[model samples]
Target: MYTEHPGSCSTTGAIGLERTRFFPRQLITPDDLIQDQIYFRDKLRRHNRLLHGWGVVCGARIKPGTGECEIVIEPGYILGPYGDEIYIDQEVTVNLCQQGTDGNAISPCSDMTDPWCSNIRVDRQSNKPYYLAVRYAECQTRPVRVVGTSCGCNEIECEYSRIRDSYAIKLLSELPSTYADPMPQPNLDDVARCTPDHACPACPTEPWVILADITLGAGSKVTKEGIDCFAHRRHVVSFANYYYLCKSTTLPVVRSIFPGNGINLNNDQALLREWAQRPLLKITFDREMAMPKLSEPDAWLRFWQLRSDDNLTVVRRIFLALSPENPPATDESGFTATYQLRAGAQELFQSRFLIQIRATADTITDTTTPPNLLDADFSGTKLSSEQLNQVWNVTDQTTLSIEILNNLSTTDATLPSGDRAAGGQFHSWFAVLG
Candidate 1:
C-alpha cells in the first residue's frame, strides 16, 4: 500500500488512500469492503478537521438555571477538535452545581455525559473550577447476523454492522494532553492507513471543545462570579464568510480610520487608488472609557506611540494601546503633535498614530505629562488641575484624546503605561488590503 501527505506538517496534512483492484470472478472478502467504507469516511473527517477548523459556531451559552447548582447549555452547533460536527437541536442542561448525597458511594472517575445527563455528577469534597468541554464520540451497536450464519466457512462477517456518531459533554480539570501527531508504532490497520510517520495527534485528546470555566460551592446558587464563559469559549464565524476570507477572494478597503467620528478623510481618486494597493490594519475604540483616577500625575501614560519605520509591529498590542509596547520600537519624534494618523501633508489617516494625553495644564513645564489630546481640553468640565482626577462627567479616553490629538502632533512612545484600566477594552478585527 502507498500513502502520501501534503505540506510540511505531516499530522495536519491530508492522508493518501488506495482502492482495491478487482477482476472478473475475483473473490472479495469482508475486509475489503470494510476498508473501502473507511476510506471515504476518513476523507470527509479530514476535510472538516483540516480545512474548516473547529470551534463553537453558535448558541452554546451557559446560563443559570432554577436549581442552585445547575447551568443550562443552549442549543448550538460545535465543530470538535477532530472535525466532528455536533448539532444539539434542544438545550442541554449540565448540573455542575450539585452532586449525589450518598457518602459511601464511589463516584466514577468521570461521568459519561451525553444523551442529556445520563449519569450523575460525583461530588468531590473540595470546590474548585471545573473546565467544561465537549468532544466527538462514537459507539458500535446494532448487532446482527451471527458468525457463519450464512457462509459455511464460519468466518464472522462484521460483528457490529453500524457505528453511531455521538458527542460527550465532560467536566475537565485541565485541557486534555495532546499526543503524537500520529501513533509511533503501527498495527495492521495503522500500517494500512496511518502510514508515512504513523502518528495522528487527534487520537488521544478527543479534541475537546471547551465550553466554560465554572465553579460551584457546596450549596450555593450559580452566580456571575462563578462562571466565566468568555475566557475559554472560542467563537467561529459563519463558514461561508470565513471560507471567503481564507481564500482572500474579496479584500477590505477602508477609506478612513475615523469615518463616522466627524473627521473628513482625503478621498481623492489618486489617494483612493493608492490606498487600494496597500494593506490597512486598525483598532477602533468603540466603547467609552475614563482615564484612571489617581493622585499622582507621573503615574499616568504620557505618549501612546503608533508604528514607526523602525518599530517592530506586534499584532497582540492592537487593542491594548494603553499598555506599553515592549523593548521600545523607536525613539523617533513623531512628525505630528496632533492625533493624526499620518505626519505629512497628504494625510488620509491610514498610518498608525500615537495617542497622547494632556496630563497637566502646563504642556511645557510638565512635559512628562505630555500634551492634551482631543480638542486640547483633555480635562473636560473640570474647573481646576487639582480636580482633573477621574471623576463624574469626565469624557471617555477616546473623547478626551481626540480634543488634544486634533490640535497638536504626536509624541515619542518611548514612555508607556502599565495600567490596564488606563485603556478601554474593545474588540479588534483585522482585514487584508488587496
Candidate 2:
C-alpha cells in the first residue's frame, strides 16, 4: 500500500484499454490478514492518528526496482503556532504511547506506572520503520482552529489562511492547573555525597590516592609526637622498588615494636659478618600512618629536611663470584696453595656474573721454554650475551697437548728432508689431570 502511487497506468484486455489508477487495486486487503478480517482499515486509522498527534502525516515514495511498491511512509507535516506566520527549522516534541493489537494507541492511566512513551511497530519485521507513539494527554494543549485545503494549491499559503480565519470548534478559556506549574528537577547533592571515595565523585579519604614518590624502596619518617613525614619519594632504596607512605609518630613505635624492622648494626664489621654468607639482601621500613596524604614531587622535596637520616649507613665494597670449581691460589713453582678469598654468592638483582680461575705452580724446573705461560686464547667463536656467564677452570694439575706443524706445500708431512713437516700454527688442548 505504501509503495504504489494512485496515478500509475495499467494495460488491459484484447481491446487494449490503458487507464490510470489513483491507488494500486492489488493492495493487501484485510481478507489477506491471517487472523482479523478487518485489521487493514484500523491500522491505517492508527497510523493517521499518530501522525496527526505528532504534527506529521504519511507521504509515499516510489521504490526504484518496481514502480508499484512504496519504500516508507515519510512524515509530511510541520509544526508552528497558529497566527504566528513562522518558518520552523527544528523538530517538535512528540507524544508517544504503545500500540494495541487492534491498532489503537494506549497510555498509562493507572497509579502502578508513570507516564512514559514507547515505540509503536507498524509491522513486526526488523527493517520496517516504527513510530514513537505519544499519548494525547502527554502533549501540550493549544487553542487553534485550522482547516485543510486542496492539495494542488500552495500548501504553505493555504495552511496559513485556514489557521488565521477558522473558528474554534471546541473551547476552554482557562489553562489546566497541571499546565501552569514548572517541572521539578531531582535532587543530586545526596547522590553525589553517597559515592565512595574510590568511585565516581571521589571522597577525600579514598585509599590508594596515587602518590608520585611512593615508588620501590621509598621510606617515610615519624616524629616523636605524631608527624609522619616522607622524604623525597624519589629515593630508590636498593631494598624495595615501590613508593612509600610515611608517618612520623608511627615509625618510632614500629621501630621500637620491631627492633629489626630495618638494618640495625651500627658497625660495618657486624653487618659484613651477618651478610657474608647471604646471597641477596633487602631492607624495608615501617611508615604506616593513621592518615596517609598524597606525596607529590614538590611536597616530598619540601619535607626532605625533616626526614633526612644523619648517620645513614653506607654499603661498602662487596665482592660477588659464582664458580663451580674455584682453584686454590698458587706460586710460580706449580705448588699447591691455600686461599682465603671469600667466594661471595650471587645476588638476586645482578644480571651478569664473575668467575676467577686460580692456579698454583708446583713443578717449575726452569727448563727450555717452560710451557709458555698458559695464555687463555680468546679467538673466533660465536659468543653472545647469554654465553658471557661461561667460565673455565684451569688449575696447576691441568695438562695440555700441543701439536706444531710446518707447511710443506704438499700433503705428505713425512716425505723427505726437502719436504719438511707442513708448516702451520701449533694447536694446544687443555684438560684436567683427571
Candidate 3:
C-alpha cells in the first residue's frame, strides 16, 4: 500500500518496495527582503542623527564668545545577510541646537543693549561640519543721570563736539549717567560787546646774530688789512706755494676790503708785483720767485686754473713742496697725504682750508708717471664735505685730522729737479665762516 502526505514525496523501488521522504517549503518572499533593507537604512539614519547631536553638544560647550553651535554628519557602510551584503551607509544631515548655561534649549538671539553679546556662524565647502558660536553678557540696570557744573568753556566745548561727532546716540545713552552735560551755547551778545585788542606780538630784542671769523695760525693775528669784504668778508691765508682767500663772513655783512685796512696795491704796477706786496702769514719759501702771483685780474683765474687743471699732479707737487724729503707716505705701492687741523681748545662754527700747488714736470713717461695723471687722485677723504652746510661741528678741544689717498702707482718716479724742485711749495690756510 502507498500513502501520500503534504510536503512528502513517495518513490517505489524496482522490486515494488515503497519509501517516503519529506521536503521543507519556502516561506520568505521578495517583499520581505525589501522590508529588511528599509529597516536597516532607518537604523543607520537614526544612528547618524545621534552622532550629529553629539557633535553639536561638543561644539556648544567650547563655543567662543556669542557664537552659535555647529553639527556635522558622516556616511558609511555595513555588511548584511540580504542582497550583496546590504548597504549599511546612508546620507547624513547636520543639525544645530542652541543651549543655555543650564543645559536647557535656548534661542540664538543677540541683545542689542548688551555690548558684549555677539553671534557668529561659519560654513565650509569640505566634509567638515558647520560651526556656530554665541557670546552672551549679563544684563545690568541703567544708572540715574547726575548733572554737574561745567567750567573751562573753550575746553568743554571742544570735548562735547568731539564726543558728539564720534559716538552714536544709542552708544552715548549707554554711558554713565553721571557724565557731564554738553557745553553751554556761546553768548553772541556778550562777544559782540567786547573790545578787540589788535596789538601785534612782541618782537625779539636782539634778533639772532651770526658772527664769522677766520684765523690764520696759532700766533698769527687776523686784521681788517688782509680781508677783502664785499657782501661778505674774505680772509687770506698762505700755505705752501699757494695763497687762499676764503670768504669768512655770512651773507649779511658787506664791507669793502680796499677802503679800510685792506691790502693797498698800485693799480699801475704789474700783476706779479702787486701779488708780492701782500703779507705772507704762517708760510715761508726758500726763494721769493717761488711764490705764485695773487694780485689782480689774472691772478685769481690762474690760481683756480692750477687746482682744476690736474688735481693729482697738483697734489703731488704740493706733497713735495711741503717737505722735499717727505714724499707721500707709502702703503705697498700707493701713496697718501695726511693733514692735521690744530684747533686746540677753540670751538669753531665753520672751518675751511684752501690748498694750492704749482710745479713743472721735468720728466714724463707712460710707465713712470701715474695713470690718469689729470684725474684728482688725491681726495680730501678724511675732512671732506659733500654739501655746503656740512660744517665741522666739533666739540670743544677736539682737533680734526684729514687723510688724502694718492691712487698713483708711480712708486719709482723721482721728484722733479732744478731750482724749482728745491723751492717748490704747498700752501694752505684756515678760515671760520659762520
Candidate 4:
C-alpha cells in the first residue's frame, strides 16, 4: 500500500508483482543441457594443452581499426607421446585479413591467403625464405598433415610437401625430440585439467603457450533479446509480488512557492528565495506504492516554483491528452483553454504554458495526422514580455482556485463507466500561485 514517489505511477515504473505465483511447463527437454555439457567439456581441453615447449599459439586480433578483439587458436595446441618431429609438427601462425569497405583485404596475408583454406609452407630453395601456397581441404579446427616422396640416392624417400625445399626447418634452433618410443595417449578429460607448465613427466618440456587479451569497443550493438535474457535471469530472485517491508525514505528537498498542501500561499518573496537554494525538493508521500504509468490520460503532475529573490510566486500545472478516433491535423499545445485562476473567474487561452503533447495512438481509418499534445491553460493570457511582470501584488492574503479545461475534440470520447475503471483521458490540478 506504500508508494515511493507519487510519480512512481509512470508506465515504465510499474513492473513488479503484488503477489507470488508459479507456472508449470508442459514437457521436459534435456537436449540443450546435454549439448552445453559436451561443448564445455571439449572446449576446455582444446584450449588447455601446452605440448612441445615450443609450439606456437595462434589467435585473431579484434582491436579497433588498429586494435585487436578476437583471439581463437586453430585446433589449439598439440600434444604427442613421441618427441616433436623436425618439420612435421612445426606450428605456423597467420593473421586473418579483415575485409575492407570494398570487401577486399587492405593488407592481404598473401603467405596465408586463407587459413580457412589450406596449409602454406615457407619456400627456402633460394637464399631468402619465401612461402609457397599449396592445395588442401579447407582448414577447420583440425590440423591436416601433408606428405611427399624424394627420388634419388642422396635423398631418402621423404613423405612431405617440398614447397619450402625443407629449408624452413633451419629457422628453428632446437629440433623436436625423437618420439620413436610412444606412450598411451592421456585421457582427454585428465588432459584438460593438466597445466601447460607440465604436459607429462616423459615429454621433453612444456610447449610455449600464448595468451591473448582483448577489449570490446563501446560502439558494440546489443539486441532486445539480450536485455530480455538478463531480465529473465533477474526475475528468478525477484518473483512477482511478495511485497517487502515498506519504509519511508527522506525525499530530496525542493522549494515550493505555494506553501502547505490544503490552502495557504505564504506568498512571501523573501521566504521563497531561501527555499529555492535548498538543492533538492523533499516531499514525504507517507508510504510506498508500485511505480505509476505516466501515459495514463488521467495521470497529471503538479509543482510550485518561487523566484530566487523575495518577490514572486509561480504555480505550475500539467496534464495529458489522448488522440481518440480521428486525430487533429496538428497537435494542440497545453492541456486546457480556460484556467479558473479563482472561483467563478475563467480565463480562456488558446494555450496553457503547462500542457505538452507527447505521442499519438494510431487511428483505424483516419488518414489525418493525429494530435500528439494539446496544451490549453496558457492560451489566452497575453502575458507577453511585459504582462508576466505584473506580479500579483499581495497587499492582502487571498485564496486562489485553479481549474483546467480540456477542449480537445476527443475530450468527450467514451470511457469506462466506473471509478475502478479508467476515467476519460482528462485530469485536473489546482494550486494557489501567489
Candidate 5:
C-alpha cells in the first residue's frame, strides 16, 4: 500500500528515501499554469492596441455660391485606406491649404471667405503627417417656403434650407508595371514588303506574277456622304501553278547531282530571278476641295480582292497628315488624321502603321486651300505571315479580281462639306512558276 504526502515521499523504501534526499524541485499546479497564460495574453492584447489606433481625421467645407462641398482627410501614423480596408504600403501623402482670392493665407475657420474644410493625418511608411482641404457646396436641394396669414390681413413667409451633401475619399491600388508600360507598337513601314517602283519588286525573295496594272486616269470625284467611288480590274492564273507551285515538276528544283544527259538550269535560275519583278499596287490621293464648316469630314479608301468564287479579301492601311500652313487658330484646335487597315471585318492595325504628314487637322475650316497629298505603300506581307499563308493555301484556280472603294463621311456634326478628287495606280501580283 502507498500513501501520498503533500511535500514528501510517502513510501518508506530506500529508493524513496534516496529520491527525497538527493533531488528538490518547486511544484506548479494546473491553476498556476493557467494564470501565467492569461497574464501573457493580456500583455499581447495591450501591445497590439497601442500599435494600431484611430489615426485618420476627416474635414468638410462648402464652396462659396455653389452646391458642392469637398472632403479633406489627414492620416496619422497608420496605413491609408485601400478601398474600404487599409493597405500597408504608405507611399502617398495628401496636401491641403487655405488660400484667399489673391493666393494669400487665410484662417481655416474664420478668415476663409469661401467655405473650406481642412484635416490632417499621418502616413504609416514615413510616419509623417499630411494635411488636406476641400471645398463643398450643395448641388441638388431646393428651398421650401412656409406662409402664414393673420386675421388682420398680414402675411408672414419663411424659408427652410440646409447644406446636407457630403463627400468621401476612396483609395485604389496602383496599376501593375506590366500595364503601365505596354509592348512596342507595330509599324506599317516595318511590315511592308513592297514599294512603288514598277521595275523592282518590294520582296525579291518571294516569287510574284503580275496580275493587273490599272492607271486611275482622271481621278474620281468624291462629294456626298456615304457615296462610293470605285475602280475595278480582272485577272486570271493557271491551274497547275495556282494549286501546286511547290510540287509541280515544271517549276525548277535544286538537284543534288547533275544528270548524265546534262540539265538546263536556266529555268530554275529564272524562277529565283523572278522575285525581283514581283507585282505591286499603289494608290495616290491627289486634289481635294472643302467647304469651310465647324467640323471635319472623314474619308476612307478601301481595297478588296475577289476570287472567281466571290470570296473577298480586304486590305487596310492608315495615313496620318498634319496641316502645312501652321495657322495660329489651327494650333488652338489640335488636328489628327489617320487611315487604318483592316482584314475582312476585323481592324488589326491603326495609328502605328499610318503615314503621318507634318500637319493634322481635325476640322477643315478653309475649304479653298489646296489639299495636302497623302501617300501610302503596302505589300502582301503587311497582311502578316499567317494571313499571307492562308491566302496562298487556297486550292482552287480562282479568277483574281481587284477593286478600290473610296468613301467620305462626316465624323463630327460641324464637319465641313467638301469635294475631293483622288487618283492613284493599282497593281496586283500572284505567285507563279517561271
Candidate 6:
C-alpha cells in the first residue's frame, strides 16, 4: 500500500460513487456517513504518505522529565508509517522505565526476572540496548453529557468526541523479547526495520524511526534508584560526504547523553533539513583498539542515502576499510617489535553507491630505536572518486574489497614480513541536523 507512486490520481479509486449513490427518496444511514468519512480520511493519509514520505516535519523536541525514568516530548508534528498524522500540540511525558503497557505505574521487579519477554508482548529490563521511538495514536476527548437510556449501558459510551491523531513516545527493543531468535541484523536498506515483537503495543511493524539507543545499568528499579542516575543514551554518526552537516571524518557528529536524553537520529537522511516536528534516532558506542598496540583509529566515513521515505534510512554502500572510532587490532610479532596492522574488514551493501576512502601519515617513526632510519614505515593514498567507482559502480556487487598493499608498511625486518594493513574507517551513516 505504501510503495505505489503518487503521480496518478487513481490512487483514491478504492471507493466508487456507485457505492455511495442514493436514488431519489433514498435514506442515508449513519453507517454510510461514517464509512464515507473514514474512507476519505484513510485515502488522504495514504496520499500523504505516498507523496511527502514520513518523519517529523516540525517542532517536537525531547527534554528531560521531572519524575524518575520520565521523558518529556515537546509539541510537534510528524507523519506516521501508514501516513497518519501525529500532532503533539502540547508537551507530554513518557516513562522509559515502564513495567506495564497500560501507562500505569507498576512496582519495579526486584530481581528483574522476565522470561516471557519475547513470547508475549512484555517489557524487560536489560543492561544492553533499547530504542526510543514514537508513533501516532488518539483517544476520547470533549465529552458531551447525554441522558442515559433506561439501561445503564451508556455509562462509558455516548462520548461527543473521539479524536484519533496524537503522538506516542515509547522505548522499544529492536529484537523480540525472547532468547530464541538470533541477534537482530542491521537492515541493509532501512535502519528502522527489525525482527521486532509482533505483539508490541508500540506498533512493531509500523513505520517508526529510531531516536536513540538507551542503556540501563544492571539492577535499576524505578521504585528504588532513579533512571536519571542509571540510564544512558547516545547518538553517533560519521562523515557521509562533504555535503553533510559534519563534512569531515575526523570530527563526525556525536550527541552524547544529557539529563533529558534529547538527541535525533535516523530522521535527517532526507534531502530536507530538520526544523520543527523532527523525528530522531539515538545510539551508543564502545570504541575498540585500532591496531594491536597502536593508537585508536583517527578517520572514518558516515555513508547514507536520500530517498522518498524520510522515515526509512537505508544502509548505503560503504567501504569498511577502518574502524574510525576504534578499529580492531592484534599483535603478531611480539613486544618491542613492529605492531601488525590488520586491514579493515570487507564492507558489503546491496546497492550501487559511491564511497569515500581517507588515509593519513606519509611516514612511520620508531622511537624505541636510536636515530638512523629504523625498521618499518607506512604508506597510503587517499581514495579518489574514480577509484571508488571502480568497485561501487559495478552492476552486480554487494561486498567491498580492501587493498593491503600501500596502506600498510611491511616493517619489522626482525620478523617475517607479516601481512599487515591499517584501513579502519567508520561504519554507518546517520546524520543529525544541528
> Candidate 1: minimum summed lDDT over ten consecutive residues — where?
425-434
List the lowest-lDDT window of 10 residues for candidate 2.
299-308
Q: Which stretches of candidate 3 lie over 4 Å from their true place?
A: 1-283, 290-349, 361-434
lDDT of the candidates, in the order given? 0.42, 0.20, 0.22, 0.23, 0.23, 0.37
Better of 3 and 4 by TM-score: 4
Model 2 scores a TM of 0.12
- Residue 414 error for model 5, in Å? 30
Residue by residue across 45-105, what tens digits does model 5's lDDT show? 2332233211122211111111111212222122111101121122222221223332212
Per-model TM-score versus the true fold: 0.39, 0.12, 0.13, 0.17, 0.14, 0.35
The residue-level lDDT of candidate 4 at 133 comes to 14
| Model number with the top TM-score | 1
Candidate 6 similarity to native, TM-score: 0.35
> Higher TM-score: candidate 5 or 6?
6
Model 2, residue 307: distance off in Å is 36
* Candidate 6 ranges beyond 4 A from true positions: 1-19, 99-126, 142-148, 151-161, 175-204, 217-434
User: What's model 5's lDDT at 80?
Assistant: 15
For model 4, residues 59-92, the per-residue Cα lDDT tens digits are 1111222222111222222221112211222323
Best by lDDT: 1
> What's model 2's overall lDDT?
0.20
Report the Cα lDDT for residue 144, model 1. Answer: 66
